[model samples]
Target: MLKPEIKVLDVQGQYRIHTEFYRSDTAENTIILVNGSMATTASFAQTVKNLHPHLNVVLYDQPYAGKSKPHNQHQKMLTKELEAQMLLELIEHFSANYLMSFSWGGTAALTALACTPRRIEKAVISSFSPLINGPMRDYLERGRRCLADCNRTQVGNLVNDTLGKHLPSLFKRFNFKHVSSLAEHEYAQMHFHIEQVLTCDQPCLLDTASGIEIPVLFINGAWDEYTSASDAQHFVQSIENSQFVRLENTGHFLDMEHKSASHISKAAMLGFLQPAHAEHLAASR
Candidate 1:
């Protein structure tokens, strides 16, 4: 039931990133949490509360997403590299040692961690593909069309349908009763990111695998509709010192379960970090 201290960070001396920092006395190491494209720090509320007892957790809104939207006044469009640089600065500022990310944030995390492996000792990345796979490409296309038509009904339907498809068994876990709660500016930002995802062809992580010198743990649902389990395997195989764990009876939202403290996702993360820390301590001895 612990809460994070809110702060506005000036990353890379350019962008102002809004972040939440949670401190824990029983902490093993600091973990930087990167949320999915559509998510804010609130998306990781339960997970953070569960982890705050044992780990120092930091959550942030990426540029043009959530609370950081107003800080993105630069003329240059948001790109993976730009996001990576901002993340690196944030990590340095916060003195965090571990990186944990979901979905699009995974891409940015991978890129940033690859470039600064010495700074980030370990990573737990979930549902992130190095490339835009076929299914994801199709999903982006649908988003592109939805943005082009500028229809609220179409947008709501598209998002709900996509959610239903990805989270058939767990759709009720989310609060989608107020899709209308999304503000106009937020909608435009979503459209812009979708366009970038569709148009940008640059590989975010796989190409820079050689630069990642730290241990990595990749987590994904066995039935993730947006990304295949094979892609998670590909990431593990591509990155050295990387491991993959596929959760059963789940979809893309691994942390979406509306549980209190003992969710599988939270356990898996704590398990990985604890053992990794033990190994680090042993090596130091």
Candidate 2:
């Protein structure tokens, strides 16, 4: 039910991309789900599987994330704006209609939406604080450190310390194993996995948040030490026609580790993507 539907298309050059369609039979325009840095398309499988079967749900791995092949010269070095640009190429390629982005992917999704301005019906951003600049810059600094000091134990301790501020209950639920895999990533991997961590600009996030005029829905876990609720609030305040949802008892990866939390978040996301899910009734209608 949930797998990467990777297809290689020559839209100018060969592009290998992954897409998960919840209901391939339905002709409805799809809701594109974009992953945060270093995350794969697999993260959204459970969410899309649980969503109303009438809609076309999709999540894809950007160049370096999953099954898609990474091209050193093609990557533009750690920036996925073109990753988003390619998403739009796939959108036109597949004719999708909506989008949802998490963390850094929010920047990419916005580019895809903005380039084809009228195409996206709605977009949802979770655990993201694009319009607010400072925290992300700070986070990126740490990311650079993470790559530089691949001392697993030391880096792990540092990451744990950074996550310490989120309330203990949700913090206990944190997925260290899930993130710990970062330590095992091939050191010789593209960008040394360093290019985007360093070169990718944080203001690109701020500018994207401010630029798009689409109907936006923001999701953040109240205890999310990663992306503060205040920053999410700032974007809601700035972006016209945007709504915010804070899921209780969860940390950063609401869509992954927290089941009920993501279900609750999905209800709001469903409402935001109303026109498609509305066809039924009070039951995801």
Clashes per model (N, Cα, C within 3 A): 0, 2
Q: Provide the lDDT at 172 for model 2.
A: 35
Worst 10 residues of 1 by lDDT: 171-180
TM-score for each predicted model, relative to the true structure:
0.84, 0.76
Candidate lDDT scores, in order, read 0.72, 0.61
Q: In candidate 2, which residue ranges exceed 4 Å CA deviation? A: 2-6, 10-14, 24-27, 70-76, 131-139, 152-204, 236-238, 275-285
- TM-score for candidate 2, please give it: 0.76
Model 1 TM-score relative to the real fold: 0.84
User: What CA root-mean-square deviation does each model show from the true structure?
Assistant: 4.4, 4.4
User: Could you give candidate 1's per-residue lDDT for residues 14-76 as a string of tens digits?
Assistant: 788999899888786788898776678877876686567667999998766678877777455
